[model samples]
Target: MGDGRRGSIWSIPEGQGRGSRPAYSRAQITGAAIRIADADGLDAASMRRIAADLGTGAMSLYRYVPSRDDLIELMIDHVLLEADVPERPTGDWRADLTLIAENTRRMWLRHPWLAGLQRPRATFGPNRMRLLEFAFGALDVGFPIDEIFILLDMLNGYVERVVRGEIEWAREMRQSGMTPQRWMTESAPYVRELLGTGRYPMFERIVMDARLPHMSAEEQFRYGLDRVLDCIAAARP
Candidate 1:
């Protein structure tokens, strides 16, 4: 990369300290942003807000970190560090992958704002690279590079969608102050009318039977992960 490119925020090489002690490290700035985003949401994490939190003028922040977009890239990579992608992988690919999925889901759930990050602008940082490397190591199979990447994409997509839905539900419930039980009570009359019409046989049957297991968020995540892993394995050989 060119010198200009090397100095960009996405490049972790710049994170190395200057000869003298710097006023602040990228870790401190990124940490402040993460705390803001985690407590509030992504929009709440502006450069000015973070600068105020760090007790510095907003303009000075630019001297340390280039821009808000770069700070976002830094925040994302810092958040990935919480996932704790293990360096040592189990010999069993399926088990290792399950660990990866669980860790990823756990991180997203902890930081709900992360679910809404713009994917097109995702800039991989140092920790993200390490996370990807660990994930690749977990895939013990002798799959081609293309197929392995496809598997990683599938896994990442599945976890992101699932966690996004889960966070949305919790956010909606909090915003509306309507518990699921209260929601069911409020909609009971309309639901009864729809069921009484006998227009929806499948819905009627599911309601009548209630046979499906009411899995918690974690359980539901694992259930879907298992099925996806099964398909990937079956497709392999």
Candidate 2:
């Protein structure tokens, strides 16, 4: 004997049952939630708001989405459809990883709320599964599975770190009119004073000799990504 409860939204069939067709769909609800989140951040995408956006009662949405957690998972997966990766990885692992990295960055920028999701969940929605296959399969060289996991983590970690910084910087600019160029210009006197002391050799070198700080965000990201890929190349058998 088994209970008739469904554990996950993914497991539940859409509009399941032979009654009159449902008034709204999970896709419609999820899409509305995404649009709200994109415009006003994640917390604004409440069930009530989403329902109002669809011109229905909030209670009616529960019949389709069940719960807020389920809705969030759906939203997360729905945006990943924009990642637009190929059906299969090319044999050139570096090129494949580069494609993944670039697409992932663009996706996160388009959905800055994604950077706010701190906890990792085991939700394997279809788009997520496809991306996981492409990323894991890209590193399907001679490395062991565990090593492949580590390598992918390393690559994703780098991308996440850089993209998070970019997201926050953009937010800061919007909120306070702060940008790298403006900050550099405003802080140049203090930076020069510090450099004049010559006490911090590495700091002075970074100030004087580093091209990274002077480059645009895109240039810096590409340069660092190339270095990371080079490291992966060095580790290869």
Considering every candidate listed, which one attains the maximal lDDT?
A: 2
C-alpha RMSD in Å of predicted model 2 compared with the true structure: 2.8
lDDT of each: 0.78, 0.88
| Candidate 1, position 96, lDDT | 78
- lDDT computed for candidate 2: 0.88
* Alpha carbon deviation, residue 100, candidate 2 (Å): 0.6
Candidate 1: lDDT of 92?
81
- What stretches of model 1 exceed 4 Å from their correct place? 1-8, 15-21, 210-213
Can you give the TM-score per candidate against the true fold? 0.86, 0.94
What does candidate 2's lDDT look like per residue over 1-237, in tens digits?
A: 113355778988899755688989989999999999999999999998998999988888877888778888899888888778899989999999999888888988999888888943557899989989998898888888888888888998999999999999999999999999999999999998998898999999888899999998989999999999998888886
Weakest 10 consecutive residues of candidate 2 by summed lDDT: 1-10
Task: Please give the distance, in angstroms, between residue 132's alpha carbon in candidate 1 and its true position after superposition.
Answer: 0.8
